[model samples]
Target: MFSVWKISLLFMASLALTAATIPGKKDRRPLGGWTDVNVTENDSGLQKALEVAIREHNKASNDQFINVVTNVIRARRQIVAGMKYSLNVQIAKTDCRKSDSTPENCTESELSRLSQHKRCRFVVYLVPWLKKEELKQNNCD
Candidate 1:
């Protein structure tokens, strides 16, 4: 006794529900674990590279910030897998200086006004750290 419209609506709703309930396939590698390494506050190239890497990684969201360091070097190959875009990154010669308080403790305005001089510099790579082999290959000591 259902009307054509009602049947169609029910079918569509069922389809939507089924799709929602089904979990997506898991990715072997996820980009959520990565971070950005900027030599300066306004370094567009580094930002673009990070953006490209994130896009290539197919991560769920791009609102998060990642700090690329030596620790991330182990996953370097995975990170750069589909990155077609380019950006200049350098090995951080020195450690990044810490602020008196954690990022959460800082005000939004203060965080927004952050500068690159406070971060490390080495300009060939944008990640925080590099593996020995990767470093050697990139000529980044």
Candidate 2:
């Protein structure tokens, strides 16, 4: 048992050292699939994408309660024909039910059946010239 504990500690230390020595690995290219973008929660583009994503999700989801973004974890941008944003966000359930309400006026729901929190990854595509925003994907856990 002592030997196993010592070995585990040594292994963990080695893994930490290895990680610390490794350089951030990625070649930032123009067409790279998803590159981290410098964006804040206040960024209009990112905010728009989040709204569109949530709205689209609500439309497609079977859940009666609506969900809204609580925070943005990560946001990445990809260039193809248009700009595609891949965002990892924290979302929580709201008091509003999809059947008769909208998220704009809904508050967070903390009640038993309404309490739900999830990390969602949403891909939103934007075409500025055409003034369009579309959701490419919405996945949550």
Candidate 3:
């Protein structure tokens, strides 16, 4: 007993509601326990991603910290859905500076590139969802 126009209107309203409910591409912070940094062609992007991951992990786990080992940064950009990053980061659980060293003021990026720190080598792979399995099998440790 409903007209075609009425049915179409109802369908459109339902579609609109569904679209509104779908989540946007939010900058989802890295999962709590492990920190993951995405490597991009641009150094700035890599640094930003690493910083975000570290911050996320620290926020989630107050008693633990992820320390970036500056000397060991190896990253490759992946060509997927345009361009994505695959960052190979070496991290430790302690801060980069030691308790005895001269307290030096350094930026996050600078700290990532520093050479002196206790190393607890653990590799984490980050890729676009599409290439996740391939990257994971090859990179994750």
Candidate 4:
């Protein structure tokens, strides 16, 4: 009787240990995707806008990330095409950072803000393009 009880207890302990070592299914996906924009320099204003939009989105019941894409489409009687824009967004629970060092690398205060507010961390991307002449024109501005 004593040997049987000891064997049962050992089996239960091993099973518990194995279960504790395995990761939960929900904890697996990557945090964010690459941005579509070719950013040569850091733009503070754009970053701020993204942060604000993300904060609002995550505060809602559904947690999702937003993706904005743009395309040029021809308009009637126009030599150039009009820009077409679309936003694709969805929410899923995800791990923001797997390691402790992420907070150190974040420039935007949004990460810290999310931590304090107990909100989901949202990922966003903005894409924009300009013709050569348009780029030259904007270069002077």
Candidate 5:
């Protein structure tokens, strides 16, 4: 029969192995890295709004998808253009709530640890594109 200490050591080793096998949270990202899209010819307001929406969305959730709603609203209707734009943003899933908030106070090592969990998510909608034709529509094929 194995001694008491010998059995205890074996049990501990088995426990460690089991823990190691458990999967940890994955680092999620958009299909491609950060993408830059032209918001409009010279519409800074629309750009700011889009950035704000993305930041807020990240705060609500760290998932790898964004929900953009295209409905006619007062503010959205003002930005009339011959073309439309789309932006799919993704933020890291870390304990750090805000992108700016993390860089200021969190250390490299600390940030590395909190990146192993899942969180809530939300979406927003803006519509100013349905009226526009395709990019090459005006040009002959």
Candidate 6:
């Protein structure tokens, strides 16, 4: 009986050790991991990220008119030194330019042979406390 009890205790100890080493559902959010954020969640933060992307896009674009996000397709986030936002969005060309009176209510270009709403993916890194955002990458089609 003493030997049997000793064996059961050893087995339990091994099981406990294995549990810690094995990855589980709870381990999904490990350090430096990216998390899929709902497009509707964190409205202000998402908006800021979108703005950064749009500003950068306009800066690099040769298109005559400015582009604006028409829809948010998806969003992801990673916690780095500050935070990183990954966005997949649909953008439409607008009639407003840099000197336009107001961008609001600007007509959007139609999705036709010559022009179409673009699907864009942008990755932005931001340090919130500093209120600064850098566009790490942008791709659109």
Candidate 3 error regions (>4 Å): 1-42, 60-62, 81-83, 95-141
**C-alpha lDDT values of all predictions:** 0.35, 0.80, 0.44, 0.33, 0.39, 0.81
Arranged by lDDT, best first: 6, 2, 3, 5, 1, 4
- Residues 62-131, candidate 5: write the lDDT tens digits: 4443322222122231222332334333233434445345333433334334343322222223343553
Candidate 5 collision pairs: 61-120, 69-125
Q: Better model by lDDT, 1 or 4?
A: 1
lDDT tens digits, residue span 11-32, model 4: 9999999999878986643334
lDDT of 3 by residue, 1-141 (tens): 999999999999999999888767674333342233434344664554444444443344444334443443655444444334445555444443433222123234535433344432222234534443222222223
The model with the greater lDDT, 3 or 4, is 3
RMSD of each: 15.6, 15.1, 12.6, 21.7, 22.6, 5.8
TM-score of each: 0.19, 0.68, 0.32, 0.23, 0.25, 0.71
In terms of lDDT, the poorest run of 10 residues in model 5 is 132-141
**Consecutive 10-residue window with the lowest summed lDDT within model 2:** 107-116
Best by TM-score: 6
Q: Where is the poorest 10-residue window by lDDT in model 1?
A: 131-140
Point out the higher-scoring one by TM-score: 1 or 2.
2
> How many clashes (backbone N, Cα, C below 3 Å) per candidate?
17, 0, 3, 3, 2, 0
Give lDDT tens digits, candidate 1, residues 1-141: 999999999999999999887767663235534444434465554544443343332222232332232122212222443322223332221222232333223232342323231222221233434321111122122
Which tens-of-lDDT digit does each residue in 55-139 have in candidate 6?
Answer: 8888888876777888899998899998899999998876576566233444454323345688999999999899888999999
Candidate 5 stretches greater than 4 Å from native:
1-36, 39-47, 62-78, 81-85, 97-141
